[model samples]
Target: MARMCAERVIELDYSCNGARIRLVRESGQDDARHREAVPAVAAPVVVQDRPPADDDAGAQSLPQIIEITAQMAGQFYITPAPGEPPFVTAGDEVAEGAPLYIMEVMKMLNRMEAEFACRIIAVLCENGAGVEIGTPLFRVERTDHA
Candidate 1:
């Protein structure tokens, strides 16, 4: 995994077979005391194979997890401003079109919204940290809509 840490955002990137997977975390402060950034480098990966009989069961048992990716690369924010509560957190229920996070690109703050009703399972990026195109900001489980 390649970790990119900045004063504004935290990014975790993993690559396998030429495919890049990114995880983002929002930071609360610009200070380094917030969290240590992981260096961006190609990390060793291990692959495991499951027996044929387990394949079907595994596929069925796994819950569907949806990734919310960044539309453009820039800084990711969890709040509208400094010292404010984050827009969303893990386990928060969100409706379609709800504002989830914001990306600051070229001095513009672009709001990112949810595409469908879901519950946030995890937040991948840190606030004020830089991210790349298609970097995942959140992992959510789709919820049934009325």
Candidate 2:
């Protein structure tokens, strides 16, 4: 049994006697039963680096866009209450620690905040939508970058 200390999930790959096997296990799961098996000949691994930019001059001047993703799986909410206005909208400037949105997990509400001052470029998730961990919630451009 493999122990997952800090990670929430773990994936492992094994090759034995020309057979390829993939094992996916979540934290706290003790079972290691083989899940997916594929012929070694049918599986190929490919790794590639980013291609060079076409126009270096323009690329260098472009503003950096940052994506904000959910830290946990939950139901996403735009406003604190049903009749209240949303915490933010596209083009809104937000300060560090400002509330961005709310996430409801297991009937508990968690307020999400901005880590740095930024301008909201877009709201990626729909209101009242179910979201998984690492789901993109917003796109923003940092305003405090020096």
Candidate 3:
């Protein structure tokens, strides 16, 4: 789906499982020049592997880790604002629908939230740094009830 503004366009795309979604906005172009153009949304892709059973490694399945990624290309902010505590940190327990951070695109602050509860294992991006669409922001292990 897409929506067009005066000089920008916003689009949303999702997968069958809905575990991955992408939101992207493009601006700075003349609306008249790209009125008919449709922005593309890229969904997160995952590939899994299984080790041979004869290997010494345990037979347990690999933990399902979800990588929280940036939906748009922009600057990422860990804190709500300067001088404020971060919305979340490594080892933090994130609740579903809770704001995880912010992404600034085209001078607009877009709150990026979690779709499911999870425990943060690592933060992949630095605060106030530029991030591209689908860039991994956090590595998290999904909660049992997620």
| Candidate 1 lDDT over residue span 1-146, tens digit each | 23345433366688999999876778465566755543332111111123223566675565556677766667889998999999999999998778888777667677767777879888989989898867777888767421
RMSD per prediction, one decimal?
17.1, 14.1, 13.8
What tens-digit string does per-residue lDDT give for candidate 3 at 27-53? 545556645432343223222233334
Error of 3 at 8 (Å): 17
Q: What range of 10 consecutive residues in model 1 has the weakest lDDT sum? A: 41-50
Colliding pairs, model 3: none
For candidate 1, give the lDDT of residue 77.
Answer: 95
Task: Compare the candidates by lDDT and give the number of the best one.
Answer: 2
Off by over 4 Å in 3: 1-30, 34-62, 144-146
Model 2's number of clashes is 0
Residue pairs clashing, model 2: none
Candidate 1: Cα lDDT at 1: 27
- What lDDT is reached at residue 141 by model 3? 74
Question: What lDDT score is found at residue 115 in candidate 3?
Answer: 77
> Would you list the C-alpha lDDT of every candidate in the order shown?
0.70, 0.73, 0.71
lDDT ranking of the models:
2, 3, 1
